[model samples]
Structures are given as C-alpha cells and as structure tokens.
Target: MTSIRRRLLLSLFGLWITVWAAVALTTLDRSGHEVGELMDAQMAQLARVLREISLTDPQPAAKATPQALSAVGHPYESKLSYQRWLGDRLVASFGVAPVTPLAATIGFSDQEFGGARWRVFGLPGNAPDEVLFVAQSDTIREELIHFLTIQALKPILWSLPVSVLLMWLAVGEGLRPLYRLARSIGRRSAERLEPIDGDGVPAEIRPLTAALNDLMERLDQALAAERRFAADASHELRTPFAIIRTYAQIARRSGDPAERQAALDNLIRGVDRASRLISQLLILARLQGEPRATGRGVASLVRAAARVVADWQTDAQAAALTLTAAAAEGEPGVVAVPAAALGILIGNLVENGLKYTPPGGWVQVAIGSGRGSVALRVTDSGPGIPAADRERVFDRFYRPPGQAQPGSGLGLAIVRRICDLYGLRIEIRDGADGVGLSVLVIFPEPSGSPKAHPP
Candidate 1:
C-alpha cells in the first residue's frame, strides 16, 4: 500500500537535497575564486616587501643567515619561498630557491620548480637588473581551499538532523485531521445515519466529509423507506389473509349450497385481493431498487396509453363503463424515458381509473404534446379526489376517506414513484366536466426529435 506521509516526506526531502547540492556546488566555485584572489594579493605584497628590503640593505652581515620567509614560522611556511637577484647573481635566498627564473612575466604565473607547481609573483628591484620573486606551492593553496570549503559546509551538516526532525513533526501534524476523520468513521455505529459534523474539520478535508454526509443521508432515507414498506405490507396483507381464512372456515362448516357458495365467493375475493396486494408490493420494491435508465431510446406517450387502454378495455366493459384511448393529431408525444417504465406508469394510472369509476361512467386515456413536454392523461368519471386529499393520495397505502373500493391503495403511489424516477411532472385535477379525477403525467421532451413508434 502507498502511504501519503511517506510520499510527501520523500518528495520534500528530495527537493531539499537537490537545492542543497546546487547551493554547495555554487559556494565551492565562488570560494575557490575568492581564495585564489587573496593568495595572489599576499604573494604580490610579499614580493614588493622583498624588493624594498633588498634596496634598504645592499649587503648583509657575513654571519647572518637568510631570514625565514614566514615571520611567524607557521606550519605552511616551508611552502613559501623568495629570491633576490643582483646583477645576474643570486644575492639571498629563503626556502628552496628555483634554479631558473620563477616567472618570465612581470605579474604572476604558475611555474613548475623543484618538481612542484608554484604560484609566483615577480617584482622589479630598486637597482637596475635587480628583481625579487615570491612563490607558494600549488598543493598548499589547494589544501587551504579545501579546508575553507569544509568549514563553510559545517553549518549545513550540523543543521540537517534538526531540520529532518522538524519536517517529520510538521508532516505528522498536518495529517492529524485525516487520522481523526478515519477514527470518527470507524467508531460510528452501523445503525447511525446522522450527518457528520463539519466543525473542526480541515478545509482541505471538508469536501470529503460533506460527501460522506450526503451518502449517509441517502442511506438513512432508503432504510426508512424500507421500514415503511415492510410495516405497510404486513398491515395490508394481514386483513385479507384473515378474511380469507375466516371465509374458508365458514365454507367448510356450511351445509346449504347457497351459504357455502357465498362463503366460497368471499374467500376467492379475499384471495384475489391478497394476491393483487402482494404483486403490487413486489412491483413497488422492484421499482425502488431499479437503477435509473441511461439509454437513448424514447418512450411514446401515445403508444403507451393505447396499449394500456386496450389491455383494460375488457375490464372496462365488464364494469359497464365506457373507455377510450386517443392521441392528439400532429403531436410527437415522445419523451426520453425507458419504454418499460413508461408502460408501468401508464398501466397503474389506467388501472386506478378503471377500479374507482362507478358502473356506466366513462374513462379516457389521451396522449398529447405541448410546449416542450408530452402528457399522458388518464381521466375517470369516478368521484373526484378532494383538493386536500389529492397530494396525500400519492403516498403509499393512503386511501381517501369514504371510498368503497377493493384496492391496496398503492396504484397512485406506484405512479408517483415512477414519475419521480423519470423526472416527470404529475398533476391531479378535476376531469373536463369537473366531476371526476384526471391525472396528468407530463414528460419532458427528448433531447433529439425521435419518431413516435407504437409500443
């Protein structure tokens, strides 16, 4: 596994090392130049002093030895040498004097003498043909330069350990918030779905926490919906099963054919009601779990309505009701939705209309397009839902007051859920005569114009 802390430290240290190396190289180059300039100045100054001394004392005492070139007699004194020439004769010498002229030029030059490289400075003497020369060994100057460079690097070497310690501390402190967040999530109970607190969270981590909170909120909603579904299913199915069992017992005990027939019919109706409730329940569950569609296919409102109307036609005739389906001429009536979802939405609406409409009443399913939307409308001549109950009717297992109908009260709820999934606009209002219910499922126009096809 890759570690953020390790990666950050490695990157930071790598950059630091690169910068330090560059700085060290630049410092070494600059120091070398400065040291060479200082050494050359010293050699020139010594040569001038030697020329003045030669002029001040033309002759030396017979017993006097050549003065040591380095007055302080330092450890590097042996590398320093000087020579005084008077009229083609060597008058005085210190250290190892070269057999040949140390420098042919007037200023300074590097010359090999006595099997060693020397930096020599030559100056004109006070007398004609008199000259003085001072030189230092190249090996000694290099040793001094190396010593200075090491001294200059001492601070960086000494501070490295402290800097690394501080960097490690800073990295750990910066990552504290992430560790806290992980611990907080790990400590949470599975049943808890509350939003996480954003206070005290680092700005960089706030987006992550916010996304986690959103996920938790959605999970809470899904669990709540599931709980409500389970409770409603048990309550609704209990009544039908009880009724069926009671009627079955009555049918078994009855002696007369008429009584037994009535009991059997009631039992059958209870069984049918229970089966319908279970089927609708399954559909609602499936719809809740189905992933949102993401395909280019278009659903034709006209075609879906026609198919629903045909399927329910026989049922309408059995109920002694008039049912019809029609599409507005010249209207595309096409929407961007899966055909299966559209069919389920239309089927529920038509079924609800047919179930509640009284005998001899009329029901109509119509498809029309207007102003960037396609509308599939189901109108029934049943007693219309009151304005106050209209919104509530779409809630699962919510039955309107004083309505005598054999239903699980899930038809409109299913329609509402499907409409929400497809982003369709659903409206409930009075029918054309203002005496019945009309449900309008308005679908937004498809992104591209698709030819309407039959379902």
Candidate 2:
C-alpha cells in the first residue's frame, strides 16, 4: 500500500534537490563569464602600462632592453608573461615570456605557446615600430573561475541537510490532523456508535466521518430491531407450543374414543397455529433484514390482487366465506413496488381480513387507479378494529384485546413494513356500511415497464 506521507516527502525532496542543482549550475556559468571578463581587462591594462613605461624611459627604441621580470611572491606571477618587441627583435621579457610575438592583433586574443594556452592583450608601443604583449595562461583563469564558483555556491550546498529537515517537519505538521483522526476512530468500540467529533477535523476527512456515522446509526437501529424481534418471538411462541403439548397429553390419557378424537383435533389446530406463527416470524425477520428500498421492478397491482384472491379461494370456501377481487375496466393499477412484494402486501391484508371475519361474511380485494395513484382496498365483513387501536395494530406482536381469531399479529406489521419500504400509504377504516375492517393502500403511479412477478 502507498503511504501519503512518503509520497509527499519524496516529491518535496526531489523538488529541493532539483532547485539546488539548478542554482549551482547557474552560479558556475555566471562566475566563469565574470572571471573571464575581469582577467581580460587586467591583461589589457597591464599591456597599456608597459607601453607607457617604455615611452618615458628616454632610451633608443631598438636598443632599449628592460630587465627580465620574474615571479616575486604571488602564486599567479609565474603564469603571467609579457614581451617588448622593437621591429621583431625581443628586447625585454617577464616570467615565462616567449621571444616571439604573442599575436598579430593589437587587442585581446588567445594563443598557444610553450605548450600552454594563453589569454594575450597586445598594444602599440611608445614608438611607431614598438609593440608590447601581456599574456596570462588559460589554465590559471579556468582555475580561478572554478574557485569563485565554488565559493559562491558554498552556502546553498551546506544548507541542504537543514532544508531537508525543515521540509520534513513542515510536511509532518500538515498531516498531523489526519493521524489524529485515525487514532480517534481506532479508539472507538463497536457499540459506541455516536457521531464522530466534527470539531477540529480537517475538511478533507469530514465527509468520510459523516458517512461512517450514518452507517453506525443504521447498524444500531437494525440491532435494536433484532433484539426486539427475538424477545417477541420467544414470548409469542410459548403459548401455542404449550397448548399443543397440553392437547397431546389429553389425547394420550383419554379413555373414550370421542374424547380422544376431540383432543387430537384440538392438537392439530394448535400445531397449525404454531406453524403459522413461526412462518410469520420468519417473514417479518426476512423483511426487516432487507434494505429500506431495493432493486424491485414495477408490477400491476390489479393483477397481483387477482392472483392472491384466486390462491385464497379454497381457504375462503373452507371457512364459509366469499372471496372476490375486482378492478375497473381499462384500469391497470400499476405500482412501483415489485410483483413479489405486492403479493406479500396484498396477501397479508387479505389474510388478516379472512382471519377476523365470521363464517358467511364476505372478503373483497378491490383495485382502483385514479388520477395520480393506484389504490388497493381489502374489505371484510368482520368485527372492525376500534379507531384508537388501528394504529397500534401495526406494531409487531400487538394483538388487539377481544381478538378471538388465532393470528401471529405480525401480518399487519409486515404489511406496514412493505408499504414503508416503497413509499406506499395505507389507512385502516370501517368497511362499506360501517360493518367491518377495511384496509386501503395507496401507491404512487408507476412509470416503468413491468419486470418482476410473485413466486
């Protein structure tokens, strides 16, 4: 894995090194140019002085020979050379000066003699026939240029380690906030789901902390729901299991055949009720486990209701109840929820109505599509729920008092969960003629093609 600190440090270090090298090279070039100009000026001035000295000597031009100059105390004296020429005969010379003319030109020029390159300045002497040349070795000039260049760059070169140290410190200080944020998050326990402190947080990391806080909040809610579900399941299952066991014991001990048969029938009904409770618990758990909204496709509410009504036809007949489904002509009743979820929503309402309604009552599943909504209504001629208790009925494992029907109480709760997931609106009211319970679910008009169906 790549580290942010290391990448930043490397980039800064490379940039510093590049700048240092550039500055050093520029200094070297500039120093060399300035040194060459200064040396040329000095050589020219010396040649002019020599010409004046020869003019003031008051000596014959061809016979005037000055004393031979040698190195005094300076290290550069040996590298300097001069020649005095009267009509091509060498009259006087200095350290390492050759007998021949340095150059044909009367200005500064470079020449090679005595196996060494020289920068020579030539000038006209006092007499028209006299000439003077002053030269310095190219090697001495080059050595001086290099020495000056190094002296100019000394400070920059010496400060490299200090600059690197300061840069590292600055980069570390800039990244300290990120390290603090990481440590703060690391110190948290799983149950400590509170939002992270936004104070003093760097702007770059705020979004990440916000997202993490949201996830933790959602996880906390889901965990609380699961805990409630487990408690309710345990409490609700105890009664049915005890009833079945009691019935079994009665059947085993009864002497009369008729008594035994009655006990067996009760035992079967108890087993069926327990089985249904378990099924509803599992369904509720599965529904709760899913995300609030999923990748479900649009489906026809009318078609799903009709199918559910057909599936429950036999059960309705056995219970001595009439079950029917209807939809207006040209009304498709399209809804955004998936077909399978629609099935569960309609199935739960229908089952609730059928379970509560007495024999000889009728249960109706109606679909209606209006201007901006598709509505599903399940009405049953049963004992209607009180207005005060209707809202409470959606709570898990909450059965209204005076309810005689055997049920898991999770049916309406499941229905409510489904509606909430897909933004469906539901209402519980009295049936037609105010005789029984009616559940109306309003779905927002769908806009997509149908893709899913109930299993």
Assess each prediction's global lDDT (C-alpha) against the native. 0.83, 0.86
lDDT of 2 by residue, 30-79 (tens): 98889899998888888888877876664644543434544466878778
lDDT of 1 at 439: 93
CA deviation > 4 Å runs, candidate 2:
18-157, 167-187, 294-296, 328-333, 370-372, 446-455
TM-score of 2: 0.72
Q: What lDDT does candidate 2 reach at residue 181?
A: 77
Q: For model 1, what is the error of residue 128's alpha carbon versus the real structure, in angstroms, after optimal superposition? A: 11
- Residue pairs with colliding backbones in model 2 are none
- Give the least accurate 10-residue stretch of model 1, judged by summed lDDT: 60-69
> Clashes in candidate 1: how many?
0
Highest TM-score scorer: 1
Q: Could you give candidate 1's per-residue lDDT for residues 272-367 as a string of tens digits?
A: 899999989999999876545544467777777777788888999999999998786766577887778878888888888888899999899888
